[model samples]
Target: MRARHGGPAFRRLILEDPACGFDARDARVTHNNPNEEHGRLLEACAAGDHGALQTLYRLEGARLLGVVQRIVQDRALAEDIIHDAFVNIWTKAHTFDAERGSGKTWIFSVARHLALNHVRRQYREVTVDDTTAEQLDAERSLTASAEIEDTFDWQGRGDLDRCLKALEPERRNCLFHAYVDGYSHSEIAERLDRPLGTVKAWIKRSLQSLRECLS
Candidate 1:
């Protein structure tokens, strides 16, 4: 399957109910060598073993969901990404090479990439007028400040990564925290411990720089 976007149906069709005989709690500490076992399970999945896929899900589903949910911040959307990630994992299992990387890492990367793509798509699609942006800023400024990240793993598009790298690290981080991780200006300011206005300025200038470089 081409990693069906439809959630529950695709899961049932390809994965059945993965919870049939496996307890997620048991999968956690059952193996002496998780990396090796994960590799074997992925190999089985490549050879058409649906049960192996289920085992993999039982083992890693919670963690994958956690990783994705942190990025997208929506329970429903995070669940959707997990479903799609598994579909891609199943279809692409044959392409996995254990020598190059661990199966666990590979699986997480699939989910993370999907989540990041969703966030970026949403950011690109949202067009806020200056008034709307200011309104959002005002609202955020009033709310109690919460902790957030100063930076994240940067995944830029094509030459965009080079452009991002050329900018100051703090500026690059401001952009990533805003666009990639979907943090608000207030949140970014709290995380970076800079003034909210400073965070906003960095983001605006960084975006302009990126556009100029890309254009």
Candidate 2:
């Protein structure tokens, strides 16, 4: 099914049985040290190495598809988003700053945001009234202002995971939804059945708490 859209070589690479999906286990085995390997691959990609990009796709493609599929809930749509996300990563490789976060996190963020945008756009198109849509847009702007501008060195902080675990569950859930699920304040509110104002406050406070805890 994926073959019709690519060259013979790509077709061969992607033609594994649809039923068996891409084996993440196999991909992991190919790298003894995943983080270091991914970092090197990103560096190579930044240096204009196409083969590095291909290697990254081979390693992370299946997991990226799995993430998009869970969010978009459609195999075809997920595949399309993954394609776009790869193209994005290729173009934006030079922008990746290792000091900010891990290369793997950046890669997954690219794919996850694309999937989130797709689903959010579809939802807006069908269900939003003009007034509510405008409200949401304004809310998004304000929410962006409140977002933590500096990326934490998440991988370098040994206590980061433990700190996150210490957060109140509601606050932690809000943080995860915002960062991991790519949810807006309004979306988090709806998902958590909390007031929009409350969600926004929780997220703001959570970011501050995380920074303080990690510091």
Task: Please give the range of 10 consecutive residues that has the lowest summed lDDT in model 2.
Answer: 1-10
Instruction: Give me candidate 2's TM-score against the actual structure.
Output: 0.62
Q: What are the lDDT figures for the candidates, one per model?
A: 0.74, 0.70
Query: Top model by TM-score, which number?
Result: 2
Candidate no. 1 TM-score: 0.53
Per-residue lDDT for 1-215 in model 1, tens only? 01213356534555345566644443433565898888888898899988788889988999999888878776767887899999999999999999989998898888888987876655443344645555556755557356543366675545477787778777778877765455667667777766566567668888898888888
Task: Please write out the lDDT profile of model 2 over residues 26-96, one tens digit for every residue.
Answer: 23225457876777778888898877887889889999998787677667667878989999998899888
Best by lDDT: 1
Q: After superposition, how far is residue 67 of candidate 2 from its true place, in Å?
A: 2.2
What lDDT score is found at residue 165 in candidate 1? 77
